[model samples]
Target: MAYNFKNGRESVGDEPRSGRPVEARTDNNVQRVRTFEHQDRRITVRMLAYELNLKRETVRKILTDNLSMKKLYAKMVPSS
Candidate 1:
């Protein structure tokens, strides 16, 4: 003998979705700078971002603020 509710409702437990999408970083330049520092190699921002799996803005920030690459570039420019 099987027992059933008067409404014949089926019990379904709440389950988490397994197909959720992962968030992707939008800035690639920032990631590029990070990759260069990590790998200790010179590479284009585009390539660095691709390899580092980060946003470009992140790489750009690192190069400008943390690495001081922008300062280096400024010093390289001859005084006019």
Candidate 2:
């Protein structure tokens, strides 16, 4: 960040990269994860990942960050 500022970059935000942007945490995925959770709260992160063709970490993020959910007693439940 300091280097970028010294190089005359105007903002602190990240610069655009060359490759395609990540789309794992999209709204569609979030909704799909939520629907799957509602259909079967006992679904595990690995199972969700396999079923949705997403990464385990991505599924976990959808559950914990997007859906505000956590694992409890081997089941997914709302954090609050």
Candidate 3:
């Protein structure tokens, strides 16, 4: 039996043994979130995920990990 490092197990020449699960959102979500942030609305993580077509976790990571992105998101919120 040959070892398939790509996904573990044997490879059937070129076909995938199984299909991977699809993500709920696409790259378009990133654009949408940026747009919303520019509009000056307090975008919650959940709402942004739904409207932007991204997973809540993904959006959270993007906002937290990227400084520029976080800054852009911050601009959307109004000061209390």
TM-score each candidate.
0.39, 0.71, 0.45
Off by over 4 Å in 2: 1-19
The digit string of per-residue lDDT tens for model 3 on 1-80 reads 45466558554676645675455334555556667766645767788778766787877655554314443544323222
Error of 3 at 46 (Å): 0.8
Measured on C-alpha atoms, candidate 2 has an lDDT of 0.87
lDDT of each: 0.50, 0.87, 0.58
Please report how far candidate 3 places residue 68 from its true position, in Å. 3.6
Worst 10 residues of 1 by lDDT: 71-80
Order of the predicted models by lDDT, top scorer first:
2, 3, 1
Deviation (Å) of 48 in candidate 3? 0.4
User: For residues 1-80, could you state the per-residue lDDT of candidate 2 as single tens digits?
Assistant: 57977888898777788985687799998999888878986788999999999999999988888888878877778987
Better of 1 and 2 by lDDT: 2
Number of backbone-clashing residue pairs for each candidate, in the order shown: 13, 0, 0
In angstroms, give how far residue 7 of model 2 lies from its true place.
Answer: 12
Question: Which of the numbered candidates is closest to the native, going by highest TM-score?
Answer: 2
